[model samples]
Target: MENRRFDIRKSLLRALFASLCGVSANAMATEQYPCKPAPDEGRFAWGRIQSIDPNYLVKRILGPYTFKIPYGYMIGRPTPERLNCYPKQNRLEFAFWMPDFRAPKKDMWSEPNYRVHEPGRDAPGPQEYVVDVVGLEFIETKAGKSGSPGRRFVNGLALLRKDFRIEETYGLIHVVPGQNTPLSDDYVSLSNEGYEILLECSRPESRDSNPSCKAYLYFTDLQLEAVMQFPADALPEWQKIKDGVRILVERWIVKEKPT
Candidate 1:
């Protein structure tokens, strides 16, 4: 009887310990992103404007977002990072991660070996081009401007052309200028519904060297108020989504750095 009682006590203690561990993990996960820790939900606001670092840039909340560039830094852009409509709020608090420009040699960039497309999803089908973090900036409309025009950008995770498929999608991007060029006073509108970013691989201008692997970015915004510089390296499935615009991609951003 005493042994059974002791066993019951041990089981209860184990359950309690597990519960405590789970709670601790939950707390840590929530606290990780706050600019500062808070007992409850934390709020993020606009802060400082940071310069650009060629090596590094912004990363998604849970992303395998790492770049080939040697170094990088996050910048605080002008737009709000999170804009919610429940309360009809448009908060523009942008930020970025950049490299240490001062140390040139220390900043080394490398290109990873990735196929143009994944094994299962071949070309002709929808391809995905993901990045660590991408943003759209709105260029101001001048006096002569009229209705807004849009731009298009795309990033490809894998690009499969006629010949052998490119294993790792690198610098694979495509950009389509808006209907109205910079010459127009009124061009600026990433807010458009059709605006998108895509990723694909194409034969480089020169067949001699390594096939020109690129990341294509298309912006539907009339005036690109946002300027996004992607990391040279990315994960297999790193993606971004905008609920307002209703844009989705197969490529995705990983929650953590790649192995």
Candidate 2:
């Protein structure tokens, strides 16, 4: 009877140890990704790496996405009243979509699940606007891997398609040169001048090899989708800001185990 009691105690101790180990692993994973700050020389755009509590961020928010901007630009806390200030200067801001409170199953999906939006109508069709209303057409990139068939999202959808001149590509991310350009697409009439670049992760349904990514992509190990924009007709020299843009984002590398 003594030997039996000893065996049961050992089993309980083993279970407790396993639970602690799991928690420790998660903390270690969060610690592994550190914030990297880029230097500001007053010539080109300036950006700094910052951190936020994972719990305070959106349900899926994994890390920080800094807004890279020029020397004299003013920064403001995001609000409906502050919308006018963005166009006053070469502005950079972060956007967060409200969770779908109406439908529980569609909570993680950024867009309203039951509603369908199109260019002229409010209906889901062949090119149904399944994604958010702002930039529905561009969410699913045509450049996804062969078998994966996943899509990528560019933040500030209206700015990307109309205002910013998408100049180059750093891997899958679109690099927007800071040049001010005329509105080419008639779809978006709001912004007349700006610059922007986008970094997007593969959507869950895309069959990508990365298991950590999903639709409501805040759970990914890295900063999956982000956009930096500026109010300008002509972009300043690129040599100063390009490195800052790349370095600020590189800090968020995909982890093997997401927290």
Candidate 3:
């Protein structure tokens, strides 16, 4: 009986040790990602409207899309035209489509014969609009791999993990308007000049291999959340203050020192 009891105790201790080790592994994986200031020299154009003609605000967000980069994660951005199809290669696209809220101009997608333009120019379909993304924050959620074809939610990033290995990252992005451009699409005539933009990033559903996915994507994070900041004031004339606030945003990237 004593020997049996000793064997049981040993098994229990072994289980406890195994559990502790699993927990430690998860913690270390989380710690691998760190946040730092983004490079301030990247360029961004608003809806592709002739590059903002050298406005102060346009100059600021043009900087690199630097918010935070996890050690093993990838990243990408969307062009003005690709915003419609939600480009699969370069950027993850999320849409915060509010039913009651109206767009500044017509929906280019709704247009009978829409034509997308190249980068460095706005879509010829609607009035020009600028979005001032003051700050960006990312949140990661671990979704176990069960081949369940999990349900996706807007404004959330998905971290695909199996046996603690982060296999995939999906992100949702949100963008708020900062300036207005001339009307080219009908959706632009809505009540306001601004709208919230949400973008989702993940593996292309049609891709066949990991290399194919990487060729088209910026990076991979099991899940990522982009927290875009706007100004406290809701002034109708966001464009007027865009230059000033944009410059301020450049200084607001995340910075955390490794311990």
**Candidate topping TM-score:** 1
Model 1 worst lDDT run, 10 consecutive residues: 83-92
- Candidate lDDT (C-alpha), each: 0.29, 0.28, 0.26
Tens-digit lDDT track of model 1 for 137-210: 33234544322222222111112222322222322222322332221111122333644334322323333233
Is candidate 2 or 3 superior in TM-score?
A: 2
Q: lDDT score, residue 225, model 1?
A: 25
Candidate 2 ranges with C-alpha deviation above 4 Å: 1-22, 25-225, 254-259
Off by over 4 Å in 1: 28-199, 206-259
RMSD of each: 16.9, 21.0, 22.6
Steric clashes per prediction? 86, 5, 49
Error of 2 at 197 (Å): 6.1
The best candidate in terms of lDDT: 1
lDDT of 2 by residue, 48-138 (tens): 2112222221111222232222111112222222222222222232222112111111222233232334245445433221122111011
- Alpha-carbon TM-score of each model against the true structure: 0.24, 0.23, 0.19
Model 2 collision count:
5
